[model samples]
Target: MPLHPFHGRALARAIACAIASASLGAHAEDDPQRATTLREVRVSAASHDTSVDPDLPSVVETVSAARLDRLNVVNVEDALKYLPSFGIRKRFIGDENATFSVRGTSNQQSARGLVYLDGLLLSNLLGNNWANPPRWSMAFPENLARVDVIYGAYSALYPGNAIGATVLMTTRMPDRLEVTGEVQAFTQHVHDYGVDRDYGGSRQSATIGDRSGRFAFLIGVSHLRSNGQPLVYATQALSSATGGPRPVTGAIADTGANGLPRQVVGINAEGQEATDQDEAHARLTYDITPDVTAGLTVGYWSQDMSHRTETFLRDANGQPVYAGPVTIDGRRYTLPANYFAPSTRQSRNYLYGASLGTHRDTGWNVEGNVSYFDMDRNRDRVASSVSYNGAGLLTAGDGSRWRTLDLRASHTPDSIAPDTHTVSFGYHYDGYRLANASYNLDAWRRGGAGMLTAANGGSTQTQALYLQDAWQLVDGWRLTVGARYEQWRAFDGSRATATAGVRYAERKETHTSPKASLAWTVSDTVLLRLSAARAYRFPTVNELFQGSFNGIALVNNDPRLKPENDLSRELSAEWYRPNGVARFTVYRSDTRDTLFSQTDTTVFPNVTNVQNVGLVRTRGAEASYDARDVIWPGFDLTANAAYTQATTVRNRRNPASEGKQFYRIPRWRANLVATWRATGRMALTLAGRYSGRQYNTLDHSDIHPDTFGGASDFLTFDARVTWKASDHVDLGAGVDNLTDRRYYVYYPYPSRTYLVEAKFHL
Candidate 1:
């Protein structure tokens, strides 16, 4: 295949950056010229990238505890900030609405990925957008032992949500005794059109764990207080506004994402957030004999958040204008009542999990775990308008929860033929329910629920069974095959308005998917692998039942939606030495009945709803290189680049998007990190991240992505230094967005930020 000129240029730039990164090192290690075996590769790989499961066919990218401590990790999600071919949509330090992006998956598609913390499911799969981000707050950075990311749905042990990837987070339990404490502070300067100031935050955490005889216990807690930059802008299409004599100043003239005349009036209340969040976690583990163990984990998280807005427009008297019609350069623009309305929110959540497992080196191994997430108290209060802080609306989510259960068994028998085989099977179950309602409030700050205004809620459940076998066919040859059968059902769905409500009929579906992979060792330093899999992602509850009633008729949703069927393929080649490992991979995904919220243009009325598209296609290539002592001893480098071309293939309902790029998926991305160990106790590091321009719409009409509401291209640099003052204390400092370049991913990305931290260990 030949690359187009546009993509060719990007590839060239990536190669140039790679060269620049390699040139930073001065001394290269001379590895011994010896024949290596598969055992050597497995050991070396596991030492660096600890594996959650060694039998997984796909390459697992991981960040170990040692690596995590060396980096400037503000939150648990930061540990995955620089992984190969990965993107995280964490808008700020205390952002709860954060999601992950991988090959062929957009950042907003949360259902395409799955996250697990110590065998507990953290992904809120009720929806696939901002509100459904994984519950990273449940586990703090101080307690994370390791995090592993597996790309593509090539394993039978996981469900269809693993199509994009699967994240497995393991928190450590002390064997003897351990104590750790950390404090972090960061500040970032912002200079957007109307907002210009410095925002900062601070965090503190502590963890203590110890083991006595056959029992071990660990406990950790963290608290964060942060203020973030404005996320939503109050803008008007000047071309459509009327001219008036009442004049106003301070509005900035600009072009909208659609390349149209626009005027920025002020900021919205969505992202100008000041947040205080707290999390506490505890775990207990007991050994029942030598090969059997039981464990329990409990977690709690609380959040107090407030949103504030500011206006740029001012009248002749120099008084601020937050709402109503305002004239800017003789063009009159009307700001809606909610344009600058302030709001506040509070939430308390709990998680409980338990597990029992038996481990033996030669016979059958069994493992079972169960987890539940409870939304104890969740409420949000919003002012009615800019002038009215006394009365508004209150949205409460009281009975929302999710639970998961898994049971698995594996057998490793003696080799009976020319090849040896290891077989494993598992059963999985998950269910989710949400109950959200909005009511009128007499007082926005403190008031009782007056009257119910609207409600939308639903429930979804899934059960699955899978079996997989890993076989050593011959010398340097291996093959793995797996299959999964899943049954999904959506029930107890209801959507209501002020005057009417509707209950949807139950829906059920069953699907069986097949997975296979083949690996061959070409030489001592090289290995090649091919993988293919068919997976299905069922419709989420919110996608099927969350909608409004227009004159007693349902709108904006479709309960008759179908599941997405996906077929993915990948080819990977890896080369490893004692000092480093490198890989180059190409992958493709062809999905049928892809889900998207669009209008059905084939009909005369052009009804718009959450519907299924005919097909979508994506193809990409990725190259990752990690080396120590690249060109010089004591120097290390990690770099990766990816090119993805994702587009809508068949969408008769919305023909304009049939051949356009997928929303929110960038075309090119790259990351590079270089570290220099100045001494035995000090280290200095530099990192850079780049993401190509992307559109926020399906029709590719938003060519101007640099605006306030656009997904734009950005390249950022970061630096960090670490010094071990003693055997039990570590100090670190870092700065992100070193140049303070302004960019937007719908919400402005972080500007130049300074971070400092101190860690005490015992």
Candidate 2:
């Protein structure tokens, strides 16, 4: 559907009028002497790390605790599902590989976005894949006060990672004694090819905090466990003649869009992944003076997972030949019953941070923060493909570590001139270290020892300086201008292959980014904004140094990969009333040297590596409407829709890929939520989410339906009800994907799921 230029204005006026009329008529006759206020003003100071004011031209959205609790989400990522132009690729309830996408960006491009907790970076930034996602498990949901999502990288304090969007989570420090606990249980009914069963999960969390004099402390803990469905399916190529040693049970022929016939040999190759997670966090703060505060925080997280698969292809005596030669169509074929590869993984992480800051009523304020994250342990053991019942291979993992330091100061001069300025300057330093190794095990299923096969390690450091000024040119006009200079270096980078000894290299580069935004308060109830920026994202160590060997044929990585540079622009309009807000924004971005994992298929066996894709472009528009009380009391609604066209503008390396849509990004997305408070203690909410068609491959050839790697358009409905039984107790029940819509992100997504929860507050 095409958007009319006047739709924004019409929708805004309709919402404002409805809210004003409802508020005035709600028991207003009883108080005729009281005056009505249709508009409310909200003022907030600029955030030091983001360097953005609430009233700035940039687009920013905040989700409050009340709204978050009503959603009854399982994690921080789940809470953001309903936001405009935002999507989370959560395959299952407790999927650690879950990632997010914003606007034109895909989940695989993790470096395009940024995630932060308490002004500290949480995005892994180690590699752009599912295994390397933001450390969202670090913060317990009970400890979060609010979450802020800033659109675009139109801020000097942030790096190019913010080119997509920036998510900032703020934790709360109770001013008084407080205690909270919650327990939740959920189950999903799944139905798919060779997979039809029920998966269950549960979570438990608790938090306690207290404040006395100038000292405050808070602590929280959470545990989660879940059984996920199959991760992959087993299949075999179809043959013209049927002579395959008597077909096995449950073997069915299928044809895909590519006009090829295949037989499904069995159910899920890696079946039912069971995972357990435990996490804890603590925060301590002390007031050194009336306006100065010092704080420290520590966080720990760990997970253990194991899974096994079953093969339906049996042999002559009812014995399963995990791997052997089979006669198919009179042609001898080496079929592997061990195609179902099972594995186990164990991981642990720790985080520590300290901050000192002083907030003043006027003049200048300064804040400094230092933090570190340690990937203490990460190991994976896989069953050998050659022999499933025999020994396996162990990838003894050596993980990564990162540290950051930020020092910033902001000043608001005590001037009475017609114009006012809020100046901000900051210095940032970030360091990352990564180590990975692979080993060969004698027996993985039985916990056998292993010998090292290949190992490599690397480190990166970045230093940056930025300055920004938010100038209020007049009563209703403002302009924000900023610039940032960053120096990035990769040192001690090396790769060790089984055949080759080792290769090491070091690289360095510098870039400068500039941003500018203008805002105009068109009227008491309407506003307009325009913003633009130029940003660059440096290549990651894995993208530059990691290489894979296919049967001793080395597929080399590009150490001289150029940084991704983006030029972005946005125009937005907003209308606000006391009870509602409506907004519309149109944005465009052109990026060069986009990093992509591609295959140079010209060789006998395809070689894969991260390379620079020439140029890409995206254009999109977003419209949103939110209201607390539209036409009736105790009722609220939120609705949003987004349309995006992200495509490759130029690709010299592969001419066929040009003009194709980006992978895994939908052309249209929308969400709707309606909540009704039946009484003072009871409330119900109904919501629906819709994602349009998208491709899983760069050439847009994934047209198969209900098949893995062929993602199709999907829509789902959800409903929740909450009952406040008492002042300190609450009970809730909800259903997600109520219609049981089957979907896939390469891996089949969850089906109709039900959840029940109970919480207590003191």
> TM-scores, in order shown?
0.94, 0.91
Q: 450, model 2: CA deviation in Å?
A: 2.6
- What are the per-residue Cα lDDT tens digits for candidate 2 across 600-628? 55465655678788898999998787767
User: Which candidate number maximizes TM-score?
Assistant: 1
- What C-alpha lDDT do the candidate models reach, one value each? 0.83, 0.77
The list of candidate 2 runs beyond 4 A from truth reads 1-57, 240-242, 257-259, 267-271, 315-321, 325-333, 385-390, 414-417, 446-449, 550-553, 601-606
Error of 2 at 19 (Å): 12
Superposed Cα deviation of residue 477, candidate 2 (Å): 1.5
Residue 183, candidate 2: Cα error in Å is 1.0
Candidate 2: clashing pairs of residues: 322-337
- lDDT per residue as tens, model 1, 1-762: 111123434653765567556645424654442222342123223221222556677867767686776777888889888887788898888998889888778887899999998789999898877788888899878787778888988999999999899988887778779999999999998887867799989999999999999899999999999998888887888755568756889988889888897888788769498899999999998889888888899999999999888888888999988777777886667778778889999999999999988766546888899999999888999999874458899999887999999999888665423388878899999999989899998888888998999998999999999999988888778888999999999999998878999898999999999999998888887888889999999999888988777788777898899998999999988886666667888999998888777778778777877788888899998888777777777777888888889889998888899888788888888888888888999999999877777888888888787778788777777899999999999999999888777778888877888999999989
Give the Cα-based TM-score of candidate 1 against the true structure.
0.94
Score residue 702 of candidate 1 by CA lDDT. 83
Off by over 4 Å in 1: 1-51, 239-245, 413-417, 601-607
**Lowest summed-lDDT stretch of 10 residues in model 1?**
40-49
